[model samples]
Target: MTGCLDDLDITMVEEGFTTKDLLETLLKEASQRGSREAFFVADLGDVVKKHLRLLKALPRVKPFYALKCNRSKEVVHLLAGLGVGFGCAKKPELALVKSAGVPVDRIICTGPCKQMSHIRYAASQGVQLMTFDNEVELGKVAKSHPSARMILSLATDESRSSGCPSVRFGATLKSCRQLLETAKDMNVEVVGVSFHIGSGCTDPQMFTQSIADARLVFEMGAELGYKMHLLDIGGGFPGAEEAKGRFEEATNVVNSALDLYFPEGCGVEIIAELGRYYVDSAFTFMINIVAKKEVPLDQPGSDDDDPGGKKSFVYHLNDGVYGSFSSVIFNNTCPVPILHKKLSPDSPLYSSSLWGPTGDGLDRIAEGMDLPELHVGDWLIFETMGAYTGPASSSLSGAQPSRIHYAMSRVAWQAVQLLQGKLLPPEEEDQECTCAPLSCGWEITDTLCVTPVFAPASIM
Candidate 1:
């Protein structure tokens, strides 16, 4: 992969290879590849842009990419090369990060409760940074890995949390002093405090409150004769454009709170666990229409007469709720559809319902959607799917999973090349060169071409 990008000269974006252009090219390439099912088209360049955006928004906080979001090695390798840290909740996730050559200090083992084996493995690997929220977990860490550096996890105010984890994980504010004393008694080193406002948090004030609560805990740890140097602001950053405004607002509020509570020269190191922020918009899922059924309009006296008396179009796709659409059920994400080809302004629309290629009636994707008339063999795409989609997909009915096709825009590719030139070592440079042959590939300045590579499916 490095060799493929190294051949091109690092250049500017004036050549105009936008995301729309890349998607158009990828659609054509998919057809030529003889694919008749669902596939993924991932833009590595978009991940790069998201990292830069995070830096601009929160210069004081460092992000540790959540490994449970999308565990594609390509995504991890790209982020590792760009010097991003990682957050792992399980042993496999920690191993994957290590396989990408990320050092132990750059990876933090973060979960309220963890297995003893996981603790032993992390300790053996020199991953000392971990989180705990209960006495049982504290005892486990003390017995198994007594040298571990622990961060106490606290519950957030539920009214401010959008997707709350309080019931399952974090400790309450009233319980903080007792837990700190217990840790002191167990001889476990309590060096920090952590809390998650929630996933998809809408209240920026939640951040302000969480930080203030963390400050109180920090003072408590100090009173217990412990040095509190780290503050882990857990994950909740939104990644899509519709939520970008809210994300920015939250960033501003968080920035103000950090300045007030944990400003620089305060000797406190702040880090965040961000999952969807870096990869959500970088992925687009393309599903092929496998079958279609058109139901006749109900008559006035019909048994199934809808209020609008509209006909229903049922379309079956290769992917479903058990697969890439698992986020629909797990994260409550509703993916918007886009046609592969443009329709005229005057094209007629009809009531449509999309379903997965499964025997289960519950595998519906969309219902009562007003879409232009569609047919078998046509392709439908859903964007902003890079976050919780891939890692949640399963092979529940013996259905083979879909493959991923990775490509980058010319501007993004150039940015990667520039980074590689400066960061990568000489011997490790371009040890392998691989490319996918496609007719509609990206041509940059007529001197370089960008092709998509097929990545094997990984079952969660």
Candidate 2:
């Protein structure tokens, strides 16, 4: 945590310091400097809170922060320091967590279809906790990383949860036995069962069936003489303020299922690959409007949600689906931007469509946003933009990814340091999934120490 935190320029702040407050301060500085680049203000304290809350909710399960989500180095380091394991999908990801001082035993190679080189790399590093859903993958691991402790991935019925038709990944329940048998035949060690209910899963009951399916797989592994000691109920937990209720409901559902199937002291180590649940609400993105266009309602080939709607406004932002907003294309995310400053409550609203700076036609950010008519120099604020936004980028045209200014309260930094290697007990008797709220007070004489985000030339 020292080296990672040393290289990272995190701002040390007092209690009650928020992301918006930092953004407001930066906005004025940007005005004088004429800097229009998109950026993020990430509240590291919120991330710390979520990790503590997770331990309080599911005491039996270990959390492996998935690298594919966000993959911000600072976030990874913070979580690593707090004892969250890493779920690496590729070679570079493995290097990342390893560089952060994550032990090979604490990391899981979660990618199913791994390349031969990647497998060798993982093996060379002694990262033996790999996942495979099919015999081919198992065979590859047998030949390459024979010492691997593989987790058999069981497919969940994700149609109801993912909203889209099943985008399949894991092995089906019927296929589980055959896969386990094959692992035995190939002399590959199958030590656990894993499943992802799917990203953005709405139904918590979906996890119930997956847990049941995993239990059956565990039995099958036992039948095959495989020592199954791990059960991974993979990620789908909610993170937004609105999704707090759903997250709590999911906590109850998952905890009950684990209790019923993999009870306490069951000799099974449970782990979860949580990505978005830890970072979504902690980050706020600010994109500058670079260009604007006004098209008459009668114009042909113009995009409009309301037919016969008045003039349509199109605004081009500095970052788009090609870069930081890749979630727009991949996750079907429609980002509704919040104006940096609400200048007028009575301002006329118009049919506005937001597009990223990329010249491609598919680089649209949001369509049919009922926004007050804004100008080229105005700024747009977007929250819940942390997960899947940064990691999915294609980096079209070799443009630099936006910067993130990390901040945490002194209280939070100390709190996290104290709880680094231990899980704190639930303070509230009735609240099952919540951590004891931080009792913090601001010191009037405290000074804010920020990591340098702006270059000296830019500031001047």
Candidate 3:
């Protein structure tokens, strides 16, 4: 009975009613009017910008966003606008980014299982830079495109991801040296050394340690008479405030480590591949709760700790593992729900479980999660759903995928209504504007006009 809902008040607000009312309002008046389902594929443009700002703040490291995170054309276009390149993990990703008008030179094609066709295409398109691990891969490149430019990807021990190279991509330090020797013998230009320290990396010192390992590789490359010019520090930067520590401090430590190990005048192009950090916080998924239940709690040491005893109610919402399986199973992330509409600070809190639309027991989104007791048809707004929640992720569930929507402009709703009246029917305009000038204080009078709210500097 006591958890996140411990402080919640059970009384419904007279003006607000319950979450059901708000969802019913939106469904009847808003979603029904639109063609797509109520669920949305949240946009990541703002989040991409935030990640770019963080990258730009770093002294000399350039970021190439890992495109596999989410390959929606809209998301790719947004990242391109932010001056970030694509870290393509597959052939299609390279093609997708290139088709968006991003220059070939700006793309880095990398993957352990890259086919010869993809390699040839990348080489022909002037995307000369790539990564390779084993001698077989090096031989494959040499046989197919002898003059291909490549990086020797080294396997680092700090990675915390599921695929952390027990036997996958990236050569060992010894293997890196051997691969470099093979590349030199085959006339391949080994221009860089790359390492991935893993995703959701909370330890900043891991980066410093990885840098030290990279420098040892650099020294090896140097001894082999091959002076590499690029050092790619692979991505793992956390997006959430809790997982991610102070930005400046982390970057400072990385820079300091680089300075201590990298010799001056080496002139290496420092690059990083960031996926989650860029698009993680840019969007939210608003789901409608379908059911609710509350049970009484029993004292464990007392005589009343029996099954089917009094317990707390649980709330079920649409979209579960099948829709956002990556965030749950792959990333092990818990989506925090925020009430869009205001609730009393003292609203009754309740222990709750969350289920997706399907009845499968494994379809649970959260269990024993705490929130204000959600009524059936109330909305659960999941924040930081931008990174991997999109149509591409919903392939297995095969349900109607979340409809993607966008709103970058800041024009007030009234102002947008005013502007569209001159061009088209009021009912036909679907674009929503977010603009609200601080100077005006949102006074809506006959003569009230507001200015645009474009960012003078890009959003951080």
Please name the candidate that would achieve the greatest lDDT relative to the true structure.
2
- So what's the TM-score on candidate 3? 0.73
Better of 1 and 3 by TM-score: 1
Every candidate's CA RMSD: 8.5, 6.7, 11.7
CA shift of 94, model 2, Å = 0.4
Worst 10 residues of 2 by lDDT: 451-460
Per-candidate clash tally: 0, 0, 21
Question: lDDT by residue for model 2 over 1-460, one digit each (tens)?
Answer: 4214656889987654566678888888888898998898888877877776677677788898989887888898998888888899999999989889988878999887899999999999999999888888988899999999998887777767644533367898888888888888888888898888666678899888889989999898888788899888888898776776888999999999999988998899999999989998888899999999987755532455633356678889998888888888788888888887777777767777888887778888887667777899899999888888873445573578888988887766765655653334225554553334333521111121111111111100
| Candidate numbers, best lDDT first, in rank order | 2, 1, 3
Task: Report the lDDT tens digits of candidate 1 across residue range 153-269.
Answer: 988875645454575788888899999999999999998998876665677788888899999999998898999999988778777666869889889998999999998899999
Full-model lDDT for every candidate: 0.74, 0.79, 0.62
Off by over 4 Å in 1: 1-15, 160-162, 295-310, 391-393, 413-460
Q: What overall lDDT, based on C-alpha atoms, would model 3 receive against the true structure?
A: 0.62
